[model samples]
Structures are given as C-alpha cells and as structure tokens.
Target chain A: MKIFYELGRYWIFLAGMFTRPENFSIYRKQVMLEMDAIGINSVGIVSLVSIFMGAVITLQTAYNLINPLVPLWAVGLVVRDSIIIEFSPTIIMLVLAGKVGSSIASEIGTMRVTEQIDALEIMGINSTSYLVIPKMLAAIFITPFIVLISMFVGIAGGWVVGELTGVVPSLDYITGLQSEFLPFNVFFAMVKTVVFAFIITTVSSYHGYYTSGGALEVGKSSTRAVVFSSILILIFDYILTQLILI
Target chain B: MIQVQNISKGFYGKLVLKNVTNTFEEGKVNLIIGGSGSGKTVLMKCMVGLYEVDEGAIEYDGRDFSAMTKLERKSIRREIGMLFQGSALFDSMTVEENVMFPLTMLSKMDEEEKRDRANFCLQRVNLDNANNLFPAEISGGMKKRVAIARAIAMKPKYLFCDEPNSGLDPKTSIVIDELIKEITYEFQMTTVINTHDMNSVLMMGDNIIFIYKGEKFWSGSSKDILNSGNEQLENFVFASKVMQDLRRHLKN
Candidate 1:
C-alpha cells in the first residue's frame, strides 16, 4: 500500500512537470545549461570506464574460447556484441546512476531544504517544470550520444588490448567486429538508453523534490536517488531486452 | 489588503493553525509574532497559498484566493513578493541576476530595462558595487537586503516575509526592520512579516497578531502590547530580559 502511494505520487510529480512553461526562452536556456551539466560534464568518467571495461571484456573472451575449431574472429564478435548489447547501455548507465543521479538529487534537495523551491513557487513559476523538465529533456537528448561514444571507445579499447596481448590478430578481430552485425542491435541499445535516461533523471528528481529536512535529509535523498535509479535501470534493462530482443 | 478568515490547517491530523483570522492592512508593516512552533509560519504560508487551509478561505483584496485554480492564481502570485528566512537567493546566480530574475521570467522588458530595474532595486536596498557577486560571497545582512531588493523588483502589491531577522546581529536586524518599514510605506504594499524580534514588533509593527499554540491570541498595534493582559502574549513578547527591562522602562 505504501509503495502504491509512492508510485501514485511519482506519477503526479511527472504530470506536473509536463505543463506549459511560463517562459519558453528561459526554459530553452535552462535546457542548454542542463545539457552541459548532465551530458558534457559526464564525458570523462564515461569514456574512462568504457575503455577499461572494453579491454577487460576482450581479454576474458579470448581466454574463454580455447577450442581449436573455433575461429579467433569469434573473440572479436563476442567483444563487439557484448559491449554494444549490454555493457555500454546498461552498465555505463549504472555508473552514471551513481555520478549524475546523486548530483541531481543533492542539488535539488539543497534547494528544497533552503526554501529556494518555495521562492520559485511564490514567484508564480512552475517549480517542478522549471527545475526538472530541462534535466529530463537534456538526459533524453544526450544519453544516446553518450552511449554511442561509449560503444566506439569500448570497441577501440578491445582492439588495442587484442593487438598488445596477442589475443587475436588485428585482421581477424576486425572481421569478427563486422561479422553478423545487426543494425537492430544498435537501435535496441539506443532505445534502452533513452528509457534509462528518463528513469535516472525523473526518479532522482522525485526523491529530491519531496525532500523535507535539512542537510542530513539531503544526503539521504542523494543516496536514495542513486539506489533507486540504479535499481530501476537494471529492471528496465531486463524488461527492454525481453521485449525488444526476445 | 489580505484577509485570512477562519482558516485552519493541519499536518498528520494535528492542527497547526486553528481558526486563524486576521486582516493585514496596506501601506503598513503587519507583523505576526509568536514563539517557535506556535504556527505563525504555517499561518503566513497558508495566507500565501503555499499551504491549503483545512477550513475557511483566504482573500486578496476581496478575491477568494483559496477557491482559485492554480492557473487563476498566477496573476495574483505575480503581484506578490516574498522574503524567506534563509534569503533563498539562487546560489548559482549573481546579485544582479537574482534581483532581475522575476522581471526576466515574467516581464516583456528588454535586457537593458531589466538591468536598469535590477540596479535600481539593489541601490534602493543600499547595496552598491556588488552586482557580480554570488549569494555565497555576501554577508548575512547583505543577503537579506538583496532578498528585499528581489522581493520589490516586481513592484508587488503584497509582501510576505518569514523571519527576516533570524540570523543577524542586533544592528543589522534593526536595519532590516527599517528597510522593510520604509518599503512598505513607499510601495503601499500590504506587508505581512512573521517574526519574534521584539525590536521589529515595537518599532515597525503598525499591525500585529499574536499566535499561541496554533491559535490567534491577540491582535493590536505595538503600543497596546505591554498592557494587552494576555499572559501567553506577555510571556512571548517579554521572553528576553532586555525586552522585560525595556517594558519596565517604558512603564516608568
């Protein structure tokens, strides 16, 4: 019953955020700012994690395939598909759920505790739309691009590791990357990235918007934002895969 | 003028404002005074439409505010400005941007006009040479003054302030109180302030309401306060030794 109550409130919060903005130009400017904060600021961590994860995936895949009959190009196939299908979209989002999710929550939670949200409301502004919509739109607009970067960087990392460790020849690895490549796989990854982006921004925003206490409560809301967003991302990852892949 | 009529508000089945009724007049400093958790804040919030009353209605210059829709309220809200306890300036914005925020969001004024209005407001608050500085870079008194400038930036008809002197030195508190009083008369705004500051009440409270444990206990001008014969009001108003001595000195 409590969960149902929270779910209902969450839907209402989302509904409130979709109302017509008081000023379109101000909102447009805010959207640009949010894009910088949510997307541009995140490139470094996303790239670093993607590169390392890709290298590890390649090495592990090479060691697993020991059969004499199996072609070495299969290692490249595994690296490319694994990175594109799961690691880049799902795992990278989980990492961002910690970095970006907590940030959105804490910033908003601080605003809530300090009466800044009240100040907005009293000024006849739609606080929910003004604060959250830009963040949601920015995440939806930019996460796919982030995932695309992760896919390219991850593949490149795998190629570098393969060449340096002698796991597979460059020619065979390239062949494997091109083997049985499905365009639908990229589309599927993009679809999941968009959905996960919504979840992370909205869920974290909900936690922060309803925050009622001081600094201690703000910290707790940040933790909840990350935890809940990560959990939802994993859940949706499974759901999207089942619906799209199966 | 703002009229709160028989409004009651509750939280989790416990009433925070019990049948609170009052009229805050225009062109005067109307102060709401009470001890901590006495529901003064709740009463002010309810008047401003931040909290819905469980019973009764709030009217702004005879318009039923409590019955209005959210869309219908925006026009009234645009005519209202508020100063919060924490000043509540946007942390990311500079002082000039903070004061210009309302005009930027709601008015058709061009950038030059907006900057002019912001600078005029900042100057009115006696805050000069600090346009580019962020809220974090200012002192407590300067922050409150900046908040006042922002509050008046829209040239609002009604002003609500919640504990404007909560964390200030006595000198700064007196300065804020005088600023609020001057603005109220100059703008002809129906200003409502919530505070327990005795100096503010005695100095600028043209109209005052005393709330005790979620009930309106007394209402009068500051001059009538020492002889109001309300025990709870006396206890709260004279809680400090300085106030009590001042009361004694006044009686003599």
Candidate 2:
C-alpha cells in the first residue's frame, strides 16, 4: 500500500512536468544548459568505461572459444553483439544512474530543503515544468547519442585489443563486426536509451522535489534516486528485450 | 488588501493551522509573529498558494485565490513576489540573472529592457557592482538584498516573506526589515511577513497577527502590543529576560 501510494505520487509528479512552459525561449536556453551538463560533461566517463568493457568482452570471448571449431572472427561478432545489445545501453545507463541521478536528486533536494522550490511555486512558475522538463528533454535528446558513442568506442576498443593481444587478427575482427550486423539492434538500443533517460531524470526528480528535512534527507534522496534508477533500468532492460527482441 | 478567512492546514492528520483569520493591509508591513512550529510559515505559504489550505478562503484584493483555476492564478501570481528565509536565490545564477529571472520568464521585454530593469532593482536594494557575481560568492546580507530585489522586480501588487531575518545578524536583519517595508509602501503591495523577530515587529510592523498553537492568538499594531494584556503574546514577545526588561523600560 505504501509503495502504491508513492508510485501514484510519482506519476502525479510526472504529469505536473508536462505543463506548458512559461517561455519557450527560456526553456530552450535551459535545455541547452542541461544538455551541456547531462550530455557533454558525461562524455569522458562514458567513453572511458565503454573502452574498458569492450576490451574485457573481447578477451573473455577469445578465452572461452578454445575449440578450433569456433572461428577467430566469431570473437568480434560476439563483442559487437554484446556491446551493442547490452553493455552500451544498459551498463552505460547504470553508470549514469549513479553519476547523473545522484547529482540531480541532491541538487533539487537541496533546493527544496532551502525553500528555493517554494519560491518558484510562490512566483507561480510551474516549478516542475521549469526545472524538470529541460532535464528530461536534454537527457532524451543526448543519452541516445552517448550510447552511440559508447558503442563506437567499445567496438574500437575491441579492434585495438584484437591487434595488440592477437586474440583475433584485426582484419578478421573488422570482418566479423560487419558480418550479420542487424540494424534493428541499434534501433532497439536507442529505444532502451530513451526509456532509461526518462527513468533516470524523472525518478531522480521525484525523489528530489518531494524531499523534506535538511541535508541528511537530501543525502537520503540522492541515494534513493541512484538506487531506484539503476533498479528500474535493469527491470526495463528485461521488459524491453522481451518485447522488442522476442 | 489580502484576506485569509478561516484558513486551516494539516499534514498527516496533524493540524498546523486552525481556523485562522486575518486581513493584511496594503502599502504597509503586516507581520505574523509566532514561536517555532506556531504555523506562521505554513499560514504564509498557504496565502502564497505554495500550500493549499485545508479549509477557507484566501483573497487578494477581491479575487478568491483558492477558488481560481491554475490558469487564472497565474495573473495573480505575476502580481505576487516572495522573499524566502534562506533568500532562495538561484545558486546557478548571478545576482542580475536572479533578479531578472521573473521578467525574463514572464515578460516579453527584450534583453536591454530586462537588463535595465534588473539593474534598477539591484540599485534600489543598494546592490551595485556585483551583478556578475554568483549567489555563492555573495555575503548573506547581499543575498537577502538580492532576494528583495528579485521579489520587487516584478513590481508585484502582493509580497510575501518567510522568516526573512532568520539567520542574519541584528544589523543586517534590521536592514532587511526596513528594505521590505520600504518596498511594500513604494509599490503599495499587500505585504505579509512571517517572522518571530521582535525587532522586526517593533521596527516596521504596521499590523501584527500573532499565531499561537495553530490558532490566531492576537492581532494588533506594534504600538498596541505592549498593552495588549495577552499573556501568551507577552511571553512570546519577551521570551528572554533582557527583552522583558527592555519592554518594561520602554513602558516606564
């Protein structure tokens, strides 16, 4: 019953976020700033993690394919499929669920505790729309691009490891990457990225906006935002995979 | 004038305000004074539409605030500006941007006009040569002044302040209180202030409402307070012995 009540409140919060903005130009400016924060600032960590994960996937696949019956090019195929289908979208989002989610929650929660949100409310601003919508839009607009970057970097990492470690010849790895590549997989990953972006922004915002108490409660809300976003990402990953792939 | 008639508010089955009624006069500082947890903040928030009253009517001039639609409320909201206890300046924005925020969002004024208006308000609050500095870089008194600048930037017909002097030094608190009073009269705004600062009440309070234990305990101007014959009011107004002695000295 408590969970249901909270879920109901969360939906209400999201509904509040969809109200007409006071000024489109101001909102556009806000969206650009949020894009910088949510997308541009996150590029470094996303690329770094993606490269390492791709290298690990390549080496792991090569080690497991000890039988001569499995072709060396198959290593590239496995790495490409794993990175595109799962690692890029899901793992990168999980990282963002920690990185971006905590920041959003803490920032807004601090505002709430300090009466900044109250000031917005008293000024008759649709505080939810003014504060959260830009963030959500920026994330939706940028996370797919980030995931695409992650996929490219991850595949590049696989090629570099293949060349250096001789797990598979670089030429064969490139061939395997081009072999049987399904365009739908990229589309599927994008859909997941968009959904995960919504989850991270809205869920973290809900936790933040409703926060009461002082610094301690703000800290608690930040933790909850990251935890809940990561959990929801995994849950939606399964649901999306079953619906889209199966 | 702003009128709150029989307003009540509750949270989780615990009532914070109970059947409180008061009329806040325009062009003057109307102070609501109460101890901590006395529901003054909640009452002010309700009047500002930040919190919905569980019961009763809030009227600005003649329009029923509680009965209006959200779209209808925007017009009145444009006419209202509030200074928060923590100043509530946007941390991400500079003092100029913070003051210009309402105009930027709600008005069709071009950049030059907005910047000029922001500078005027900042100057009005005696904040100059600090437009580019972020909120974090300013002092507490500057933040409060910047908040006042922001609150009045819209030339609002109604102004609300929540504990505007809570964390400030006595000198700074007095400066803020005077600034609010000056703005209230200058704009003829129906200003409602929630404060427990006795100095603020004595300094600029034109009308005073006292809330005690979620109820309207007393109502009078600052001049009448010393002779109100209300023990609860007395205890609250002179909580410390030094204040009590000062009150006695003033009377003598």
Best by DockQ: 1
Residues B1-252, model 1: lDDT tens digits: 999999999999999999988999999899999999999999999988899889999999999999998878999999999999999999999999999999998899999999999999999999999999999999999999999999999999999999999999999999999999999999899999999988899999999999999999999999999899999999999988988999999999
> Which candidate's TM-score is highest?
1
How large an RMSD does model 2 have? 1.2
Q: Global CA lDDT of candidate 2, please?
A: 0.92
- On a 0 to 1 TM-score scale, where does candidate 2 land against the true structure? 0.98
What is the C-alpha lDDT profile of model 2 across A10-32, one tens digit per residue?
Answer: 99898878876689888899999
Per-candidate TM equals 0.99, 0.98
Q: List the residue pairs that clash in candidate 1.
A: none
TM-score of 1: 0.99
Q: Candidate 2: lDDT of A139?
A: 99
lDDT tens digits by residue: candidate 2, B1-252 = 998999999999999999999999988889999999999988988888878889999999889999888778988999998888889999999999999999998888999999999999999999999999999999999999999999998889988888889889999998888889888888788888999888898888899999999999999999999899999999999889988898889989
Off-target runs (Cα >4 Å) in candidate 2 are none
Report lDDT (Cα) of residue B197, candidate 1.
Answer: 88
